[model samples]
Target: MSNLDSQTAYWDTAATTKTFTHPLHAPWLDDVNRHAAILDYGCGYGRTMEALAQQGFDNLSGVDTSPGMITQARALHPTMRFAVLDTPPTLARPDASILFAVLTCIPSNHAQKRLIAELSRVLKPGGTLYLSDLLIQDDERNRDRYARFAEHHDAYGVFETGDGAVCRHHPSDWFPSLLADFENIDTRRITVATMNGHESAGIQILARRPSQAQVGPVDSFTAGLEDR
Candidate 1:
């Protein structure tokens, strides 16, 4: 099976037995508006969405690639919106229609690029984008792991675990560069404690899409020439 297929199957099996939602989501929770639409992308088992709903955010929705998770989410939260996205997403929302998270679970840079582009297109100017994922560290252990797995890997920093599962990590500089179109509000590295008690390196970021009216230096220069 392809990596995507493998991941989907893994998550489907995991849906009934695991809860992988990160515990430290305060960065995105601080400015949440009850009236605005929020999407929990890669929302597994709808745990995060359920938490948000309990906090009084009514206009919330979620999408996941695993049907098993979607099924569990729908069963648990019958009133909330959840969709199973098995293909390239064709979200019908207008620009700036939502605030969302690009959380963990993606296994490759190509997948990350496509998702970021789609989010950028649908995110309204001034909308918030929250991202949290594994960070590439300069540790000898990580380097050794990469060296051993790079030949058979699906993407950079991605490798097959001994258990035959794919995992990916990214460099610290990756997100800020990937999100140059957005105004970064905050970024911090934190140690994530997994359910199994193993700690992992991770980073969280909060960024805002610049309003359409905000012009760059090039735009300002062109506009000045036009007025002359």
Candidate 2:
């Protein structure tokens, strides 16, 4: 199977049965316009989008790789929009969007980088990307798994959970590097509850795409990617 399918396989069957609890901080959405286009990439069960809708924001679209999750989302929010996003990971929406808790679900380093590049492509100039993800934990249980997983995965912070889902935890410096293309607004460290019932340190970052004037020619950016 392809990597994308491997990544999503667990969620297809387990999403509806489990719950993801990522906290959305107030500052992350402080500047989002009410009518701006928002896409919750990796939106599991439409939870965050539902929260956004309740806060008065409109024009929201949620997409997940797992059909079961989309099934749950559409059923829960009949009036809201939700769709299943399959392999190749191209979003169907127009050129700009917001992402919440997307990075955590991606367990590979290269995949995370590719997703950031894709987000840069689809996000309109000045569009904001609000992100929340787990950080490498200091606890023994997590440390042991991180070490054990190194033998199986390319990155040290990625591991499979007891429930059979693969997940990634980030190093503090890695967050800034992953979002190198975006203009950072604010970052905060917070403790969070994991989907599998654990407390872990996590991060919240709010960043903005540079306006058109701030960016150089498209070829200049694409040139750097060709070699990679």
Candidate 3:
């Protein structure tokens, strides 16, 4: 099968019966302000969005690069907003935006950086950003498994996926520096048991834009001038 087809199959099978009950999901949902505009980045099959909806998130949206995934999301949650987003939109406001699990699937490091920049740009000052992605861990077995996947799939640059799908496993230490522009609120490793019953490690990142109140007068002056 082609790589994309292989990926679709993997996710379809894996996602068909999975519950959105990861430990990280609850905390991330709690962190979002009520009625906030949240984007489920790479929202495969609308699991996260559906979970958030159950928690009373009315303004939630789902964006996925995969058309099949988007189709499924729409069919399942027709009342909620689902869109195929090639890139972040020109949002009406900043601080109201939140992206979850979006950047990890991008195949280019430069593209990932640009995506982060776009997220930061459109987020309102003091807006929150939560990201979760597979991280290279210390387990030799897991490392070898990932290495084999990389080799088999010919995955390179910032992201890679083989038999599994399009996924980018970042180094554990990489996120902090990459997100240095934002206020790093919390970083932790979350171990999740996948539907297949295998445990995987991911980095959970919580960051915030510098609020207008936090920006010093000098910086605000520059920002104001730039806005003029």
Candidate with best lDDT: 2
Put down candidate 3 lDDT per residue, 86-148, tens digits, no spaces.
434332323243344444445445556665665666666776667666666566755675676
CA-RMSD of model 3: 8.0
Q: Which runs of model 2 end up more than 4 angstroms from their true locations?
A: 1-6, 213-228
Rank by TM-score (best first): 2, 1, 3
| Better by TM-score, candidate 3 or 1 | 1
Better of 1 and 2 by lDDT: 2
Query: What is the Cα root-mean-square deviation between model 2 and the actual structure?
Result: 5.8
**Candidate structures ordered by lDDT, highest first:** 2, 1, 3
Q: Identify the runs in model 1 with alpha carbons over 4 angstroms from their true place.
A: 1-6, 92-104, 137-143, 154-156, 195-197, 213-228
Q: What TM-score would candidate 3 get against the native?
A: 0.71
Candidate 1 local lDDT, residue 181? 77
In the range 1-228, model 1's lDDT, one tens digit per residue, is 245523777667767766453544553565656666676666667776666667676776676667988898888888888887666444443212222223235566666666666666666666776666676656787678877777876456765555445666777878877777778877767777543344678777777777882432111000000000
Q: Once model 2 is optimally superposed onto the true structure by TM-score, how far is the C-alpha of residue 195 displaced, in angstroms? A: 0.5
- In candidate 3, where is summed lDDT lowest over 10 consecutive residues? 219-228
Give each model a TM-score: 0.79, 0.88, 0.71
Give model 2's TM-score versus the native structure: 0.88
lDDT pick, better of 1 and 3: 1
lDDT by residue (tens digit), candidate 2, 1-228: 246323666776766677667766655566566676667777778888777777677877777777888888888889988878775356676324445556666777777787777777766676677777789999999999999998888789888888777778889999889889888888888887777778889877778778762432121110000000
